[model samples]
Target: MIVITAPTGNIGRHLLPLLLEPVPDGETFRVVVRDPARLSDAVRDRVEVVTGSHGDPGTVDRAFEGADAVFWLVPPDSSLTPMDAYCGFTRPAAKALATHGVGHVVGLSALGRGTPVAGRAGLVTASLAMDDLIAETGVAYRAVACPSFFENVLEEADSIRENGVFTDSVAADRKAPLVAVADIAGVAAGLLLDRSWSGTADVPVLGPRDVSPNDLARIMTEQLGRPVRYEHQPTGEVFRTLVGHGLNEAFVQGIVDMKRAKDDGLDAGVTRTDETATPTSFEQWCTETLLPAVHG
Candidate 1:
């Protein structure tokens, strides 16, 4: 059996269909979810549902039983500190994985694991630590290391529509690899289904090329058929803005630190090979995803 957590989330939602299109023979699917209602009737009818937070020991214990592989993705809790949000949430599942003897795990993680700033990159640091905790469980783990998602721009759809502008904490000219969530899900699904690989490794899912904030603006302008510009916001301002939205102060600060680390080239260490370079590009994503969001 293969288990999936956060089946309703961005990456998880995409990952689910890929796994279900034709599940391999002798391998059944299960999902640990908080709200079974969020699952479609089609999905609910197909997979075993263990209702509750996957972070809960009891939930994972039941879900992991008889499982051969697990797709692990931690949903960030804005009410908790970054450490608690990632590591603390994952601790129980780590224990359950070992106890259940689940052999393979595909997890969501950020880029910059081996970079100098990685140790100080707040939420990214915590996520890497979580990877370590899972690795200690002796599961054949694959942390799908990723940079910023092209879909992140959708968060600024309203701003783009109204003011023809989008904002970020990174510099306008600073280029870093950005991926589409669909590609991330595709990579994760591939790992979860293939059990031949053993030992822990990071499967980097960098997109076709590195893109800057300015490049994003250019793409948005061209794709949306309007003038769109990039606006750089200070990390501190981002922290305050998010905190004002009622998020935990520490969690907001972790976002700030992560942005700072990105600005400092935290994701620039990896070389994009044929395997690491995913198919989607910023322009393609802007046309396919962002354009619809701005105009729809």
Candidate 2:
């Protein structure tokens, strides 16, 4: 049995179908979510639904019972308690993993190590701490270290569609990797299904190549056939923009700090080698995901 948290999220939503495709016959798939209705009919039909927040001990205990491999992600809590979001949320579950004898845990995290900027990468710092906490449990773990996501561009759909303009917090030439949500899901699903791997590890899901915000603008312009422009929005503005979007102040600032960290090279860990390469390109993702989103 495999237990998935945040099943309706960016990566988890796409991951469900992929996991179902090669689900070695008779294996069980279960999900713990606060609102079961958010899940699609297809997912509801396939997995056992435990309708409750994963932060709640009762819900996690109930959902994880008898489960083997588990997919984990600490849903972004807008509350002031996000420092506790991963550790607090996973506390009981970590115990549950040991008590239930779960074999593997696949988690989502950011990629930034051995960099001075990483120290203040807000949510990322907390997430890395969470990874350590999970690893200490002695359960075999794979922390998928993701860079910026292609879906992040979708957040600027209105600007791109209406005015061929988008903004970010990084410099024009600061190149960093960007992974498609589908690829993150693919990595997690592959690990969850295969029980051969053990021990704690970090799987960096670097995209096909590094790209700057200007490079992204050019790609978007080419894909949309419009004169797209990229602008470096200040960190203060990034904080305001996210807050205006209804994110909690704390969460918004975490994002602001993350952007600052990125501009300082938090994700500059790729050398274009096949080993660091992921399958999707920014253009391919724009065509398949962003193009439709912006056009819509």
Candidate 3:
């Protein structure tokens, strides 16, 4: 049996279909979710459902039972400190994996583990620490390390459509890798299905190439057939905006610190190679995903 957590989330939502398109014979799938209603009738009919927050010890205890491999993902929680949001949320699951004797685990994580700024990179630091916690379980683990997602641009679709502009806390020319959620899910699916690998490792899913905000604007302009532009927001403005939205102050600071670290090349540590590079490019994502969100 293979278990999936946060099955309704961005990466997990995409990951499920990839795993289900042609279910392996003699292999069963299970999902730990907050609401069974969120799953489609087709998916619900096929997989075992353990309803509750996966962060809860009771929920994980039930979810991990009789599981051979697990796909682990922690949903974003802006109400808590970064450590609590990542490490704390995962502590229960870590113990459950050991108790259940699950052999393999595929986890969602971020880039910047060994970088100079990793210690101060806030949320990324917490996420890497979470990887350590999982590795200690002695399960055959693969942390799908990734950079900022291309889907993040979807959050600013309105700004792009109405004002022809999108914003971020990076320099227009500073280049960094960005990946699609589907690609991240694809990597996780492969790991979950084939558990021959033993020790823990990071499978960095860098996109086709490093892209700057200016590059994003240029691509969006061409793809959307509209004059789109990039706006660089000051870190202070981002902090105030997020905090004003009633997010925890510490969480808000974590965002700011993460952005600062990214701008300083926190994600540049990994070299893009055939093994690490994913198929989707920022331009392709804009045409396929962002274009729809902006005009839909």
Candidate 4:
């Protein structure tokens, strides 16, 4: 059996189907979700949906019972401090997997994880810590260190529709690779199913290419048939704008710092393509995913 945590999330939603497609007849696939009722009927019918929180030791133990491999993802939201919440939640779950004798673990993490930055606010730092913690459990592990999500730009779609522009604190010329969430999930599903590699592995999911905000704007314009522009917000003004949108002070500061780091090329490193590298181009993602989500 293959157990999946956070199976209702963006990456997990895509991953479950991939994992199930190759299963031989009569095999069972299990999913751990906080609210099993929220899962779509199609998915609920195909997988064993177990209700539980990833942070609860008892819940994780029950979910991991009889499971051979697990796909784990940390929930990303505004409520929790990334470092404390991830460690507190994942530690017990990792222990459960260890105790249950699960064979493999696939963890979702981020790029720029191990690299130190002065004002990082510990988001990526916490992920690296989680990766290390999972490694200590002695299960075969693959950490999907993904770059920025192409879907992140969707958050600004409303503004783009109204203002004919996309805005960010990163310079218009700074280039960073952004992978689609679906690609991250695809790579993760492959790792969970293979069960061939041992020890800890860092799989960086670089999208098809690196593109700047200026390039993104051009792509959007060409695809949407509208003259969308790229605008660089002043660093001081960026924090105020984020605050106005109801972000907390700490998160707003973190966003500003992350943007500054990106502008300085902190996230510009490119890793050699791994076994799980089916790259999604920004244009391909925009046309097939982003545009439909925005217009439909």
Candidate 5:
């Protein structure tokens, strides 16, 4: 049996289907979610839905009962404090896995997580800490150190749709790896099912290529049938923009620092070929998935 945590998230939504298909004979799949009512009826019917928080020891124990492998992911949001809320949530599950003797674990982590910078605290640091905790459990672990998500672009969709322009703090030409959440989930599901590797493996899910905001604008223009353009927002200006959008000051500052890190080549590593050779190309993703999203 495979237990999937955060099964309602972007990656988890795609992952559940992949896991349910091509299963070996009688192996069952289970999903751990806080609220069972939130899961789609089809998903709830297809898999065993275990209701409880990932951080609760009793809940985790029950979810991992009879489970051979697990897929783990932390919810992304500004409300979670880096060390307290984020790492605290993962630590309990990691400890539970160790006690229950689960065979494998797949974690959804981020790129440039091992590095420490002043501004980009919390999520990055907390994820790395979770990776370490999973490793200590002695279970075969694969940490999907994914790049910036392509889905994040949706946040600027309204601006592009309205003014034919998208804005960000990073330079127009600053290239960074971006990966689809589906790709990350696919790899995680594969790892959970295979169970061939041991110890901790860092799998970087790089999108087909490195791209800039300018490239994104061009792609949007072609797909939307409009003259979309990229505008570079100043670092100072980002805080106000995020605040106007209703984000807290800490969260807004963290994003600005993350963009600054991107500009300095913090997330510029090319790991698609090294980690998962079957990487998804930007054009393929844009044509098949992103284009439909814009048009629909």
Candidate 6:
């Protein structure tokens, strides 16, 4: 049996369907979700459902029984400090992992290394720490180290529509890898299905090309049929804007710190070789996900 968590989240929503597309013979799929109603009728009809938050040991233990491989991710929480937020979530699951004898785990993480800024990279730092805690448990682990999601642009599409502009803290010309969540999901699903590899693996899922906000704006204009522009919001304003939208102080600060690191070139570590490249392109994502979101 294979167990999944966060079945309704962005990557989870994509990963779940891939796991059940054919439902391999003699393989059982189960998901531990807080609310079963959030699952689609198709998903409910196919997989065993364990309704509860996986952060609780009781919930994880219940869903993990008779399971060999598990899909694990730490959901965001704004109430705790960065260290507590990640380590606290992983502690219970780590205990359950050892108790249940689960063999493989696939997790989500970000890319940054060997830089002073990476040491204080707020949320990125916490996520890497969480991956270590899970690694210490002796299960074979794969943390998909992703770049910023193309899906993130969806959050600012409204302002883009209204003013022909998109805003961010990253410079208009600094090149950075921006990935598609579907590609991340695709990598995770492949790893989970084939249980041959062991030890710890950090798979960097950099998208097809390096792009700046200026490049993103140009692509948006072409795809959306409007003259969109890229505007760099002041670093100080990133925090205020997030707070104005009612995000918790902890999360708001984490985002600001991450953006600062990005503007410092945290994701510039990997070059776009065939080995580091993922299949999705920003232009393609704009066509399929962005265009439909704006026009339809």
Top candidate (lDDT): 3
lDDT of 4 by residue, 79-182 (tens): 55556556767999889888999888989976675455623634665677788888899898888987678888888888777787778778788887878988
lDDT of each: 0.93, 0.85, 0.94, 0.78, 0.77, 0.87
Flag regions of model 1 displaced more than 4 Å.
none
Candidate 6 regions exceeding 4 Å error are none
Q: Which residue runs does candidate 4 get wrong by more than 4 Å?
A: 25-27, 113-121, 234-238, 241-248, 272-277
Regions of candidate 2 where Cα sits further than 4 Å from its true position: 243-247, 270-272
Clashes of each: 0, 0, 0, 0, 0, 0
In model 4, the Cα lDDT at residue 108 comes to 92
Say which prediction, candidate 3 or candidate 6, comes out ahead on lDDT.
Answer: 3
Task: Report the Cα lDDT for candidate 6.
Answer: 0.87
Q: Which 10-residue window of candidate 6 scores lowest in summed lDDT?
A: 113-122
The better candidate by TM-score, 4 or 6, is 6
User: How far off is residue 231 in model 6, in Å?
Assistant: 1.1
**Against the hidden reference, what TM-scores do the models get?**
0.99, 0.94, 0.99, 0.90, 0.89, 0.96
lDDT of model 3 at position 159: 91
lDDT of candidate 1 over 4-52, digit per residue (tens): 9999999989999999998788879999989999999989999999999
Clashes of 4: 0
Better of 1 and 2 by lDDT: 1
TM-score of 2: 0.94
Writing each residue's lDDT as its tens digit, candidate 3 over 1-296 gives 99999999999889999999899888899999989999999999999999999999999999999999999999989999999999999999999999999999999999998899999998999999999999999999899999999999999999998999899999999999999999999989988888889998999999889999999999999999999999999999999999999999999999999999999999999999999999998888888899889889
